[model samples]
Target: MAFQCQRDCYMQEFVTTVVSCCPSELKLENNGKKEKVKGFNVILKDTILFPEGGGQPDDRGTIAGVPVLRVTRQGAEAVHFVSSPLEVGLEVQLKVDWDRRFDHMQQHSGQHLITAMADSMFSYKTTSWELGRQRSTIELDTGTAKPGEIEALERAVNEKIREHVPVTVKVLTLDDPAMEQVRSRGLPEDAVGPIRVIDIEGVDANMCCGTHVSNLSHLQVIKILGIEKGKKNKINLIFLAGNRVLKYAEKSYTIERALTALLKTGADDHVEAVDKVQKSVKALQKSNLSLLRDMAVLIAQNYKNNPNRGNLFCLHRKEGDNEFMNIIANEIGTEETVLFLTVGEEKGAGLFLLVGPEEIVEKMGPRVAELLEGKGAGKKGRFQGKASRMERRGEVEALLQEHSRCPHLEE
Candidate 1:
């Protein structure tokens, strides 16, 4: 039997007797965590809420004031998952979410028009389609579209919408002669009753189970956004219909205004302004790196020239990198002194390098890593790695000082 939703796509409310309601559970993800929710699977004599099928999402609404989370078709029955159970044999009111339903109707109907025009004009067959939340897509059998083909296709689809063509449904038996003319991807194995064919007068006739508008004008308009490469030798045509096009435009305008304000330029100059800013940032970064390298050499030379400087030396730079630390280590020479250097935020995660006698470096490397809440490995006379707790550097400095004072203790 055809569902009431399939029978009357425009029906918003219907009174039906509850045939059955049983305990059920729905699995859902909340904030990246998966959880199971307890619910009831309700079956009604008929429903205004369409079950998920034919690439259209299930309608969300209420059944006897209980929220319906999902609906799916099992064979001949439409199972509605609801928050609360409805008593068997009791009459209940079922409501359809009109806004969502209408949006789907517009997109589905628009797809039919586009598919027909593409096949007629370009010999491109629609192998598959998806009606998404933001935009919809139809996969064509061909790998590519000719220049101006998409624009022509878009113009043709909108012209049909302007024509206000009548869209009607026909219920035909399996043996009906008219079924031969209808386009189909073969009926479902468990399909019961007559097959429903949607006819767009003077355009196309296709077998479809989903709800649709009775007139092409209801589509308002169809916008072919662009094309995307698909698997194998197919191309997916992206598009927007009715309210979705308006929503997309509104969002795009909002982003444009924000960019214009931040760049202090008009929409037309946004690209050039961003490019110029990026180039300037890159030049500044290059200059800063050169200065840091020069500073590293000067600091190392100062320590080497100072005869009064202790065997243990420590330094931290907010802007130094691994290369800067290596440069300093090479300049000062680690044979006679223990050099402890760090780079990045003083109280946060950063890089650390320790260089000294092989014995001292190997023994103190792991301890320094632990105090900084990090890890490191060393061989010969150098140790280095990333540190997570730069705030604990004082502890590492103290350990190094003690080692320098009693250099023969470990030996």
Candidate 2:
């Protein structure tokens, strides 16, 4: 027998007897952690909740007041996963989530209309399709769509929707003559009983197990968002139908309003304003780099000119980068003096460089990296790497001071 959902897509409530309830484990994610939740797989005599199949997600609702986490097709049965179990033969009221079910119906039926029109009008074959959370996609066999072809296709699809074409379901045997006319992607090996076909009036006839709306008017409208390059020799057509189109438009408008306020520009000028801001930021970054290089040279020259300055020198710059540190090291000359330089937040993550004698740098590099919660490597007389605990800068300076005092200790 056809499942109650497949039999009547419009049914919202139904009374059914529990055929079986088996103990099962359901995996759930909570706060980014996966947990095995104990549950029961309840099989009913018939169900109004559609199972996961044909690229449509399973329906979510309640069974006997218990939340149904998932519904899956096992062989020819719809198994509803619930936290509580119902006794066999016990009658329970099952309520389908009307909003989710209706949304799915709109998208599924919309796909049929689109598939048929694309094939008839442009010779584009739908190889596969997916009903996503916010939108849906259809993978076409062709690698590219001709200019204006998608726009024309969208017009054709909406025209059918406005026509209020009727959509009906038919159950036929494998040997039925009409079965030869329906488009199919083959049946599952475990598929049992007769095949169910969805007929979109004079538009399309396809063999599908998923539930759909009864009329094209129910689709409200379908908007072809755009196309994306798919796998080899294929293109994915992205679209939203019915309420999804409205929701998408609402969200897009909200974002545009927010951007308009932030950029102090109208919606139509948002792209140009953002581009201008990006160019300005790039120019400022270039100027900042040039200034940092100049400052590095001056700092190194200051240290070199100080005859009374100790061999140990330490400096930290919040805006410094690797290039700045290297410039200072090269200017000051690391042969006779130890240079400890760090760049970034004083109490957060940053970069560090230590340059001096080869032996001293090699021996102190690992120790200093560990103290700053970082790792580094170097040959010759320089060591540098990233550090996470820039607050430990004082401790590093102290260690460098002790090493300078006892120069032979590094030997």
Candidate 3:
């Protein structure tokens, strides 16, 4: 609040008149954090500030050359808060930063164009919209889309952006019922007085409180990211326009440049580089498997004898990456008649099999599993079990040697 303007008597065009009157020599309040501009916040005053309401961000810029950090409506008054201390009653020239303002207008107006296009082309009504820095989104009341239909809608919208339609902003108070014709009756629940409508000229007309450009020409471009389903009958659309498009393009260019150099491929040839990675992965898998096969043969050669035909048992346990050890165990199991336990990283995790003669494997395997604190559920005339701890390795070896002493373990 300006020191000169009383809470009750601040005129409607108060901010413009008062700010112009104050000189830079006026004293500031609160040292700096919050500064009061003499002629700020009055209705109808042409000051550069985005008002806060309707989920839209507050307009930001300098007033009197001092940055107006934010703008909010106190009752009907638009209060402009400036960073640092502002000279009270100081005369300061007001300027609106067009570049930033233009970008916001582009996205906001683009939304109107989209909503209008959707209503006209597909009988869809927009329920809500969000204007973000990188993207904008619109929620519509109906959605049952196929890929082809989506593509067609996308193409239609881009065509409209290229066409460059006209958008108009209209401000109306609640007292005037004529304002009703300007937009729908969906006045916000929080609307204390007038309803501001952003009409896309002859295009879309709706009651919106957010700041928008005066014309659609300012938008310049639009890009749709995707459509997401909202409730049962609604869908949300994600898009970008103007500055957002340029920001996305700049980021994309950076990534493409880095990838081109790293992968040694032209922009169009990135796919070939990706395919090369897949081929390399496949080759590595084959080479690794061959190594496992050779290790299996060495383990098989260590087995003492083939009991009931080709059945053989060899217990070799170690610690490492669980998958690697499991693969080595699998290789050893495949080579011998009845390859037994080859425990690895997962100590309690071991291999079990029964291979040689069907009867011998079926009968002794279960008994061996019971004794070894493991399972031989699968039979190949071999049974594998895990030792509880590293110290249990000796116990397992002793048990294997004792297999000769035990009648059932012999098969």
Candidate 4:
């Protein structure tokens, strides 16, 4: 939406004259497509809703009791996006979303104080910042900062907040002497006429075009959450301000209480409790594995003593594994026998078929899986594969019996 703002905006409630209600163009976000949405951009002579700019989000509320979807700045005008059109030259009452507006003020003001202190105290210059929904971040021109340094900076910021210093905005011309005192990365190329500078009493003065609270006390408090390493050797300091600090504290306390109850240990002992439980689980797994190995050996001996079903020995055990089958095959030694083993009949099935004379097993292994509508791989005298057709286990046993009689036929 394109429009021009003749008067300065930033009033909580204001009466404005509607200049025009025209079809506005909006670029769709986050689809990598150059698409636009149709909406009415209501231009006002003056407005309270701040347009999105300077790392801050747009203010949303009602304009003439109609919900304003978004506000954008094209040149000097504040354009309000709404569903329906308003009559040109109609007078409308613009009400800014106070809760959202106040929250942004707290965070934006807190950032200025923190950035100023970071530069004055530690010589760390702020490169950029982001005003997020839950928290805010200021990127400093440094690789990293130590815990002590951050703690000290937080303390200094809170001290300024308690001081309740007046936050003032001043519009100065390009050649004004106050511009020399402004702390900024640089001015934009298209920056013309007067410049808006947010001055935090005696602490900071920076060229910015964002809304801020009237005083530092409105910030309530500033807490440094942590720091992240950003691109190009910069450090991003994560923080919360005003109501966000209260919300964060409430959530942290709730999480700590829940952890204590679940672990059956106090906050200080929770880590130790978790470590002890992990060790016990590891010991139990080791004991279970040894028992399975012993059981496999005894099962192998039973089959070795009695060559069941003539020369075709077949065993159908539920949930047996390839490891158990391999152990049984080794225990039987080098004998002239064929073993057809199957496991997991109810859900699915797996087969381990071994035939004497390694060459016969290698050639017949893949064929056994094919007969069961599955796939297999083998070498030496053992072959293992999965059979999706569990009902075909009986057919596999029958094939082994028929092959046993024609052993010389395969050779």
Candidate 5:
């Protein structure tokens, strides 16, 4: 086991000797394939880098200026994985990423206080917790939390923070009478030796291995974002603490400013304004679709007057969609005509459809898709699919025209 500083978590620097360093490789199985990754596993006599555990991320920093990529715990040892190797018995300098460490400390400590407060108030024990980059979540044992209950819990947690209670850690044996008295989530069956407990003055004490802030005041404030349903009737409480709360407020203000200007409304009226705009946009879309349908009918009537029309009628429209193509074909209302229509610009790919007699469609639909390097299917006399190789679409049209004139040309 490594010697933890125990004095203060904010202690940023240390000098330690490398106990051992090994050329390490991690083997991962992905999609039935074995992959090996090259790295180094390092051990130090004393380290300030906290390994990733207890639902909190590992501390990131430098070991003698070489980047420490990851850290993990095996038994009592905290293994530091590095990109480059360090020699055994070499004395080196260590540095911790203070900003990341402090942020984690705030969130983890805030979670502890919140969990304690909830358990005390309503017997809602914490099942699990996750510290995320933007927000954190605490899963409670209960299925639901009303808005009033949530507000009260937030108030109680913030009250503790304002009290500026000192957060202290104690190390004790399993047999110690204090062990039975402290509130713990419980210990692992295989656990041995001394257990570390975090005490928030008179509020609560629980066994925790994660780093924390020295005082509750450092938590700044605890804000409950919302509560969501979790697995098997549990409630997941989303929250932000300390610097995260300030960051969230800044982003919210920026978005609100943009919305107010775009909607020509005050900040408080933005939601109402947005609702009105959405209704207007939906009505406009319905009007445009009706206009397109009317235009399709006129085009089909004009095409029907052509004396040069053959068994195959091919058309392309840059602005057309599947609905437009289908409407025009249905308006023609002729069993003598076979329709091959494509939409979207020639420079890009788009949708296409085939409608004709069942025999002709079954024979030619697959051929068209093959030539266009796309896919489709048919039932009755209709086939539809997306085509990517529209640059060769002219060839598809010519082939269909030939087959329409002479059904046995290439068979």
Candidate 6:
């Protein structure tokens, strides 16, 4: 086995919380740009704070009472940048947010266990692992793993978490003879030092260079978000860890309460409540559609009886959905050449236009369209446009009646 000398890595502490934290190892000397004051991560020889590596988010908390913005690894070193510079050599008692740390542990350890189970059961390997803000995921090498297989693997992994297995962290060199035992050699190429292998005794073993809880009991729960086909032969899994689980629980509770109150139902009666809501919504929609149809008929009947019908009768109004205008035009269009136009439901707003027969449109469609003004235009022997206000209706109707281009064109 290759020995890990302090000189080889320039940074490596075999013991945990043993080395002096280099809070001012500040790499970016004169980065040319200045920072807006405080809040940053730091590097320490033996940091109790886990950095953002191994698909896990970094631990967040106060270092000597100063808030730690984030934790990250610089090469082979684990660093913790704090809000204020801690007294250089002072060994600040590092405190990690247990809730956040534990949640990440569950998701991370859960991923290893599930991946191992998948490999053992279906011979499907885990390609990669990703722990997101709200969810954690492990991509399996194959999509052929059935739902039953997924269920079995999930059950088995959760069972392992429940069993509270011992997570052993063994530091080994690259030249170690025992590398053959590592089933998951998922190591990054740049990790060229004493590799820390976290072995979930009797279950999963993988070469990982990330912070982990001492025991599996720290992981309270492993929630599987869902599995979907990613690429050819690849499956993606999304899941949530630690405090995020509590957040999700709270969110689900809020939604449940709102839904229950809205449906006038109890919390436990969700399915029936949903069914009731669907039925009620459908009934209301039917009633609304019926009312709309009646309104259209009524408007069209009036436009027909108006008696000031002209060949180029354009009945454009901001009444309702497009169906309303079409309905009105269809109703009166059958009796006269009517061109109905408008922008939307707000009456006296938007624009309007109307054109009768091709001959009539050619005669006065352009002139009327010009008078309507404000970015309105029509062509193809049709008067078409939107108006700035509803007052242009008289001008539009007068134009059509005076044009009197083609009476026969009224269809």
Better of 1 and 5 by TM-score: 5
Instruction: Tell me the TM-score of each prediction against the true structure.
Output: 0.81, 0.88, 0.55, 0.66, 0.85, 0.63
Q: Which model, 1 or 2, shows the larger TM-score?
A: 2
lDDT for each candidate structure: 0.93, 0.94, 0.59, 0.80, 0.86, 0.63
By summed lDDT, the worst window of 10 consecutive residues in model 6 runs over 1-10
Using lDDT as the measure, which candidate wins?
A: 2
Candidate 5 C-alpha lDDT tens digits along 1-411: 324633467778999999989989866467989888688999998788988767888888889999887777777777888879999999999899999988999999999998999999989999999999899999999988865999999999999999999999888887899988787767755455688888899998888778898899999998999899998989999999999999999999999999988999999999899999999999999998888788888888888988877778888878778899999889886877788988887855888898888888888899989888889998788888988888778988888888888877764
The digit string of per-residue lDDT tens for model 3 on 278-328 reads 899999988876766566556554543344433335455452233444444
- Model 6 has an lDDT value of 0.63
Residue 75, candidate 1: Cα error in Å is 1.4
1-411 in candidate 6: lDDT tens per residue? 122211121122232332443434333324786445444445554555666776777777666666766666666676666557655556655556766666666677667777787787778888788877677778888756675776777677777777888887787776798676776546666566676777888877787755555566666666666788788878897666555667889999999989888878788898987887799999998887778778878976876787875444445444455566556566665533656456443435565555455655566655665665544555654455555556666676665665556355442
Q: After best superposition, candidate 5 residue 364: deviation in angstroms?
A: 5.5
Q: Give per-residue CA lDDT, model 2, range 1-411, as digits (tens).
A: 579999899999999999999999989778999999999999999999999998899999998899999999999899999999789999999999999999999999999899999999999999999999888999999999999999999999999988999999998999999999999889988888988999999999999999999999999999999999999999999999999999999999999999999999999999999999999999999999999999999999998898899988899999989999999999998588888999999798999999998988888999899999998988899999999999999999999999899887743
Q: Report how far off residue 201 is in candidate 6 (Å).
A: 0.8
User: What lDDT is reached at residue 103 by model 5?
Assistant: 92
Pick out the ten consecutive residues of candidate 2 with the lowest summed lDDT. Answer: 402-411
| Clashing residue pairs in candidate 5 (N, C-alpha, C atoms within 3 angstroms) | none
The stretch of ten residues in a row with the least summed lDDT in candidate 5 is 1-10
Candidate 1, residues 33-143, lDDT tens digits: the string is 988999999999999898888888889999988989999999999999988878999999989899999999999999999999999999999998999988999999998
User: In TM-score terms, which candidate is top?
Assistant: 2
